[model samples]
Structures are given as C-alpha cells and as structure tokens.
Target: MIKNRDIVCIANTTWFGEYTKSTVQLMSRLAKNNRVLFVEYPFTWKDTLTTFLGKQKAPVSRMLGLKSRLELINTENGSKVYNLVPPPVLPVDFIKKDQLFKPFFNLNVALYKIALRKVMKKMEVKDPIVITAYNPFYGLPLIGQLNEALNVYYCYDGIGTRRHGKRIYAIDEAFSKNVDAIVTTSDYINDDKKKFNPKSYVVKNGVDFDTFYADAKNKVHKNEQKIVGYIGSLDHRFDINTVEFAVKNMPDTLYHFTGNLRNQEIKQRLDKFDNVEFFGSVKPNDVPALLATYDVGIIPYLVNDINKNIYPLKINEYMAVGVPVVMTPFADLKDFSGMVSVAENNETFVKTLITELEKDSRSAINKRIEFAKSNSWDIKAEEFGEILNKLLENGND
Candidate 1:
C-alpha cells in the first residue's frame, strides 16, 4: 500500500476551475484512498501586462512575482485535496511582454530564480509526491528545491515545438532528467521523451465511460439531420480546412461542434458553412449528455510535429459515448485503424465520412463501447496509483 503524503499538482491556472479531464478523473479516483494535493495557477496572460510593458523592475513584478501558494478542494469521497499555486509567467514571457510594453517585460532570469525560491518555500511539504500534468518548463528550477519530492512528469503535449523554441526545450529537458518517472498522454510522446529520459512511460488518455455509456444507453430522440460532430477545444491544432470539407461536402448532414471557441477568426471563417452548428463550451459534467445527440465524432488535427504526437482526449470521450470517430493520420492512433476511420487528407476525410455514414455502424458503435469499457479512467487511475506507490515505497533516491 502506498502511504498518503502531500501531493501537489501543477497546471496553467486554478481559475480554469475544472481540472483537465485526465487529471480530474485520475486524481478523483486516487483521492478515494489517499490524501492528494492539486496545485492551481492563478496568474494568466493578463497578469503579464506588467511584464509585457517592459517594466520588469516594477514593484508588482518584484513583489507579486515567483510566489507559490496553496488551495484546498473538498471531494465527495471524504478525501482532502491540497492544490498548489505557482507563478504563471517566468523569464521568457517577461522578455516578450517587455518588448510589447516599455518597462513591462524587463524581467531577467535572476528574478525567476528569486521568485521560484519563494514559491518553493511555500510549496515545501514533508515527503511530497508531486504529479505535474503539464508545464515542465516551470518544474525545471524547482526540482532541486523539493527536498523529498517524488516528481511524476505528465506530458500531455510536446513542449519544445509548441511555441518558444530552444529556451523552453532546455528547461523541459532539465526537468525531465530530474523526475523520478514520466507519464505521457501518448506513446509517441513517450518515444520523444526517451531521447532525454530513459524512464519515461506512456499512459493514454481516457474518458468517463459510465457517463457516456449512460447517454449511449438512452439514445437521444432527434428528428434533425445529424451526420457528424466534434466536442473539444478549438485550438490551432485543428485543421479547419478538413472540418470545412466535411461540412461543405455533405451539405445535408448537420455538423455539430461543442466546445469553447479559442479562435474567433476560425469561428468567423466557419460561419460560412450553413450546415455547421457551434454549441459553445459545455460543462465537463454535461459532455456525455451532449454527446448523446451526435451520430459521429471527428478528430481533425493537422499532421505536424506538434499535433501528430498528441493523444486527443476527445477520441476516448467519443468512443465511450459509442459514437464512431474519424481521425487524421497520427502515429499514436494507427492501432485504431479498423475501429476508427483514418483520413490521409481532406479529400480522404470526406470519403471516409461518406463511407462510414453508409455502413451499418451498429458494430462500430459496439466496438467503440467495448474498447472504452476496458480502458476506463478507473483502470488508468489504478495504474497511475501503482506507479506513485512504487516511487514512494522504493524511495530509491
């Protein structure tokens, strides 16, 4: 048995409120028998106005900087959550912010060192097992400070190719080296991590099977012409062209999208398609219910260095709802060939959609449901629990 200790989780923000689907599901399950602490970030892009304005030496930059705090979450399972709060923007954002606004983004790496020292002091707990879902950039400097920390670096997305090039990569690389174990969202990312760390592992993303299955059990009665749908973040990773092709080629079939629109321009561009319906961000709890209305789901990620390696959470979410999914070519999704519709390009996407639409999809639906049942979050959480247990028990360090 793994003894309960102070566990701190780090992500972009605490204000985002709802935890990342995988994080919330895994932690909620882990909290059932252990004391887990989840750290939330309070600072956002807006917080960097001072940094963007090139005012690194400003009082706010110096005083409000590099501080780590904590929050508490009360779960229904009678387990307490220790949420860790960390400073948002580090040295790089400060420089970029300074270029935009005079005296705003003038922060130096030394300030990061100072701020991190303070933040580390606040997060320092006796025998802490830290599970960071993303942002290894932030974790690099703190590794040495965490006296008795068991670091579990969970890479959801590849950091080096995302935005900032060399600097972020260097930081992430250093963090990867210091961590005890690594849990990535996809096998591709695990392969990527092997270049840096020998102990990296892949734990694919999962969904709430029970909720989606319940919705699948009670099929929504709708007279509307529903052919395909997608419910996930509308980030740059999406290939709008493919989505447009799917909607425009099949003018009669209504293409439904449900999620918060991050790109307003893309949303505007998508407006040209009359058959497309945009249902903005739904609460996480309402996903299964909303997915019940869809006939099929689409993963329209562009095949690139950044997106190609991603293991999209929506794939599992859709499958759990027993909805057939069509995906673009991705190395991680190759194993799902027969089970999912794989499109090589925009034209293939449309062709595959039409083919799937024509087929008797009952077997596909059952295959998806059965696949989801075996790969539930409960099982993934247990696997994650075992990893944490081994790390703490061995305490090899």
Candidate 2:
C-alpha cells in the first residue's frame, strides 16, 4: 500500500461542489495512507467580481483569505485532506491569440507558484508526489519547480475537444510530455493523450459502492411512483431529444433530475412537462437515499465530441443501488457491455428503460451490487497507488 507519502493534488475541479468528481473521491481514499494537499480550482478575478456583485455564488471569502484558505477536511472512512483554496487569477479565457494568452498564462502560473510555495513551506511538505487532474495549463509550468519526486498527470477528459480546444491542446501536450506518467479514467482518453506521452495508463472510474449498496436495503420513498432519475450536472452531454422523448412517452412515470443546471434553456424546454421534476442539487451524502428512490437510472448523453471521451461514474452508482441502468451508445462502454443495457437510439433507450423498470428481479439487483462492489473507490485507489509505487520503484524519482 502507498502510505506515509506527501502527495500534492492539483485538480482542475474544486474540492467542493454539488456533485463530487471521480478525482475528489480517489484523492479522498488515497488520503487514508498519504498526507494529501488538495489544491482547488483557481477562480479568476472576474469570478470574484461576479460573486461580489451577487451575479454568481463563488467562494470569494475563502479565495481572498477573508476566511481560512487552508482547511483540514476529515473524510469518511478515516482520512484527512487539506483543502487549499487558491488565490484568484486574472481572466485569461477571453485572450484567443496564443502569443497574448501565453504571457497572461505565465503570469497566472507565477501567481499560483508563489502562493503554493508559501503553503508548502508552511505545511512542511518536501519532495511531494505531484498529480494534476485534467488542468494541463497550470500543470505545465509547475512541472519540475516543485522539486517533485514524481509528476503524474491525471487527465479525465480530452480537452482538445472542448471549447478553446486549439488553444488549450498545445499547452496540454507540453504538460503531457513533461509528466512522469499520464493516468486516465477511460481507454478513450488514454488513447488520445498517449500520442503526446506514451507513459499513460487507463485506470477507469469507480463508484462509492458501499454507501449505495447499504442504502439499497433501506426504503426511502413510500409511494409506488416508479421514478427514472439522472444524478449529474445537466450539461452539454445531455441528449435533449432522448430525454424529451422519454419524458413525453412516459407521462405516468416520474422523470427526476438532481444536479446543477448548466444551461437555462434546458429548463425552459423541459418546464412544460408535468412528469419531469428538477431537485436542483443534492449533497453527495444524500445521493444514496436519492438513488434508492430511483427505479431506474438513465444516462442520456449525445454522441458529441465531449461525450465521446467520458466514462460516466453514475452508471456504477446506479448499479450499486441495485437499479437497472439504461444509457445511449455514446462512448466506449465495452467494459460494461454485458453489465448495463445500451441503446442505439432514443426510441430504443426508452424501450430498454421500460423493460428494465418492469422486470427488475432480485437476482439482477444482487448481481449489479456485486459487480459494483469489485469496482469500488477503495479498489481503484489501490490500483492507482500500485501504479504510482511502480513508477517510484523503477527510479522515476
């Protein structure tokens, strides 16, 4: 087991969010045996301004050190994580030209580097294992500056397919080449990143199986209102037509969505449906309870550029809850081909979900729970640690 190591985690996503990311869970689990410092998202000055003006709910106090910036967060199952709220950077997203963006990007890096050095010194962190999750822009400049024993880029998405793809891809490539290894959540992602760096490993995403499995036995909702639910950010990945078709056809069945709504127009479009209900956002701890209430879980993702590289965690979450899962064939789901049902189109997706909801047997539920147990966070953390340990053992340090 990888223990007693000072691990520095530089995540693209913040430690605090409505829905937990796979990176957060993996780091939390690794915290059990490691001194983990989680550096959160670097919110820009624009974000602070917006928050101060009551436009957005950004953590302005924590960002500005009005409140404690460095907090010790105790995770469930006996783990300690230091959650570091980073100082805001200058808004650089608007600068499209590479030459102009480079200077601003370098400034942001210097800003973050100075701040991080102070915290590291204060925390007495030495020769730390550096792992940046999906933010190569920040990851590139700090490559060797940390005096890091080993550098690992834990990429979860192909940023080249995202907005400002061309701009970000170049920096990401340079970062990939400099890292000791690249760990990805899907083979699809690993395949893309390996072109830049061959020292890439595909350690797929896993769920907190024990929580949902335990909750499956507890009855939450009393009413026999069969519900089809989706628990994630209703972002661009959502196949609108597929969801609309399901909501329209299954008028009697309750269609539940529980996450942050990225687009207002999705709400405008779906508001007319009486069967559809949006619970906004629920805490991670409350997810199992919510899962228990769902008769079936649907991952209605469009086969777009972004969705093509994803390995959704909600699939296993639903599986752990012992509910049947039905998703569209968006990405490479070969690993779960036999375990979960995938449909070719919207009509087939709705049909499969109906069949799943109607004939969910005790044996099937048990099988899903059992399958999910093997892919728990604990197991994935172990796999990740083993990889890190191998790198360390092979003289990467």
Q: Which candidate ranks first by TM-score, i.e. highest? A: 2
Residue range 166-265, candidate 2, lDDT tens digits: 7686778889988999999999888888888888998888988878887873332345678988989888878888888888988888989889999666
Stretches of candidate 1 off by over 4 Å are: 1-3, 13-20, 42-45, 48-70, 76-79, 86-124, 160-165, 217-224, 361-363, 393-397
lDDT of 1 by residue, 1-397 (tens): 3555666565533423322467767776777776666654335445566657885322233234343244466753355666544444443443443345323323332343455445546655566666767766556645655554687888877775444445577668888887888888788889888888887776777777776788773342354676588878787877888888777788988888777677776678787788877887777678787776777788888888887678777777788878778888855576565778888888999988877666635666777888888777878877787777776667735
Per-model TM against the reference: 0.82, 0.95
* Model 1 TM: 0.82
Error of 2 at 225 (Å): 3.9
- Alpha-carbon deviation at 109 in model 1, angstroms: 9.9
Q: Lowest summed lDDT over 10 consecutive residues: which window, candidate 1?
A: 101-110
Off by over 4 Å in 2: 160-165, 217-224
lDDT of model 1, residue 23 = 76
